[model samples]
Target: MKKVLLLLMIVIAVSCKNETKKEVKKENIIEVDKNYFPTELGKVFEKHGGINTWRKVQILSFNKGEEVHTVDLQSRRTVINTPKYSLGFNGKEVWLDEEVAGTYKGNSAFYYNLYFYFYAMPFVLADNGIIYEKIDALVFEGVKYPGYKISYKANVGNSSDDNYMIYYNSETYQMEWLKYTVTFNSKETSNKFNIIRYNKWKNVNGLILPSEITWYKKDENGLPTAPEESATKFTLPLISQVKLADSFFEKPKN
Candidate 1:
């Protein structure tokens, strides 16, 4: 009886040891995959709000001009509302409802999430299928800002040929400027890049987001020449971890 009791105690100890080992291994795996962004970009993400926190967000909404734009971050479903018109993407289709005849003249498809992508910034650049490369610094007013060139895998989106450059303050690791090429309806990619300066930021739900973005006129060399008078500004930025129902983003019936 004494020998049998000793063997049972030994077995229990071994079992507990194995369980502890499994738990440690699981934790290590999560830590390893927690951050896959490049060192500098990871710092930028951490400075804004950790990438893990951004991934937890379900809904983001803000006002652009008189239009109120809301997006489902996970699904990419969007709704833009104005007194004159309502436009939205119901996961699969882009729809428009005009209160006034011919009120919305913009392309519904292209304009759906255009500003959302721009406003989301560095976080959106961390999306899947993206290729990142460290690039030479950008100098503006004698201040050198390091940056990264972002490209996408073939067949990634509507315009996979599109390219983006993210320039951030070296000391603060905060995004300062963005330069991108528009290839939305082009067969061949162009080297021409348009620039947008992130002039102001506001914190929403612990994430630092653009409150104002200024478009700059490009010089003959495809660099920013001067800030344009008309800048895109945002207000009432809100984020929620709770997701909205699909019906909310669906096309509305007349």
Candidate 2:
């Protein structure tokens, strides 16, 4: 009886030791996988250019259906700069030119430029705004993309009326496209504006910038209407004559 009892205690000790060892091994495996999390790609995007860099841009808008209006947009310090100045004009008359002393009043084109500027900073901004989920994996233009689907509630008073879902390209660590509906004060709602592709990634002072961006806009039924439009083009001059002032973006008060 005594011998049997001693054998039972020994077996129990051995079983407990094996269980502890297995648990430690499992934890180590989880740690290794965590290192490959997709959010880390934001650091890569930042290394290229990211959203932190400030730049001046020219935005050209064309009427998709009719040939009535075409506009030029001049913006300074798209992201960080506050009280941003934008000058706009339809091909013929002055639509919006708030920068100059004798310019026109506010209009829809002015509001459009403002919305574009806010979307300049992609990943970091989204992380702060809402929840993100890993969506799928995709490849574009020979680049691999591990996709992440993001959903968030917009801030009160934002033009984006509904909750938004944006898909981020994993390999590039940038947002490829997003879908959302917007409500304007005019009581009109449109579900247009989808980013299709990012082209011409150029390095500006160690920051990779997509000089050309294309997106889609569809009508209510979601039919492919117009071939997407290239949103903006930034031409960085090798040498410049005019000195850029720190207060360039500030609105000159009357």
Candidate 3:
């Protein structure tokens, strides 16, 4: 009886030691990931509407004229419903309702999910593998704004080199201008950026989005202004019917 009791005690002691080692290992992993969590960018997300609230949202859709754009947050699938060309992505390759060939595939793929991402501000930027930095407000057009610059690490969607600089009004905490660059071939160099102003804003299903997005030509000093050639570069007026379900964004079959 004494020997049996001693064996049980030893087993219990080993189990406890294993648990402690596991807990310490888990804590060390969390400590490593803590650096990647952008606390400042999280404040921007909370200001708009907490990231947790946005996470609960399953589907978000908007209309730009006759075109419709929808995204499934859970699966990260996007669907662009358009009169001319419709697009669907099942989280991997973007499939089209019609068979696409040549450079059209690249063009279609680039444009299919582009504007939807723009319209889905703050929320879309909260994706995984994104790195954020709080920078000094950019002084432009005789005005200044608090800024957050976001970039993607490796394995971030199709393009990893793309960087976005979002400026927000300090008092209102509303996004003002978005400056992003297309570093297509070169993964490291970003010498130029096109700045677009968020002209109008509207709240849809508790998420703040830009309704009227206008493109601007940057001056030598990198100030954003309304382009002389165009009026409204992008418009997403019909913003409603936010729902959930990954099947909605899947490639439609006959």
List RMSD in Å for every model shown: 16.0, 23.2, 16.7
Order of quality (TM-score): 1, 3, 2
Estimate the TM-score of every prediction: 0.85, 0.45, 0.73
lDDT of 2 by residue, 1-254 (tens): 22222333443454466500111122222111222223443444454464334222232212212111111223222211112233332233223224444443355343534444423434233334544454444434455444444434566333434334344555555555444444555434454535344544555444454455556655554422444664644443121112233233332333
- By lDDT, the best candidate is 1
In order, candidate lDDTs are: 0.80, 0.37, 0.64
Candidate 3 on 1-254: residue-level lDDT in tens?
22223333543464466500111122222111233334444555666676666776655556777656666667767777655556778787887774443323446667777877777776677788876666667776678887777779886877788888888876776777788888655656485888887778776546666778778876786777556445343444332224434565666665
**Considering only N, C-alpha and C atoms within 3 Å, which residue pairs clash in candidate 3?**
none
After TM-score superposition, the amount by which residue 145's alpha carbon in candidate 1 deviates from its true location, in angstroms, is 0.9
Full-model lDDT, candidate 3 = 0.64
* Rank by lDDT (best first): 1, 3, 2
Q: Is candidate 2 or candidate 3 better by TM-score?
A: 3
Task: Let me know the TM-score candidate 3 reaches against the reference structure.
Answer: 0.73
TM-score of model 2 relative to the true fold? 0.45
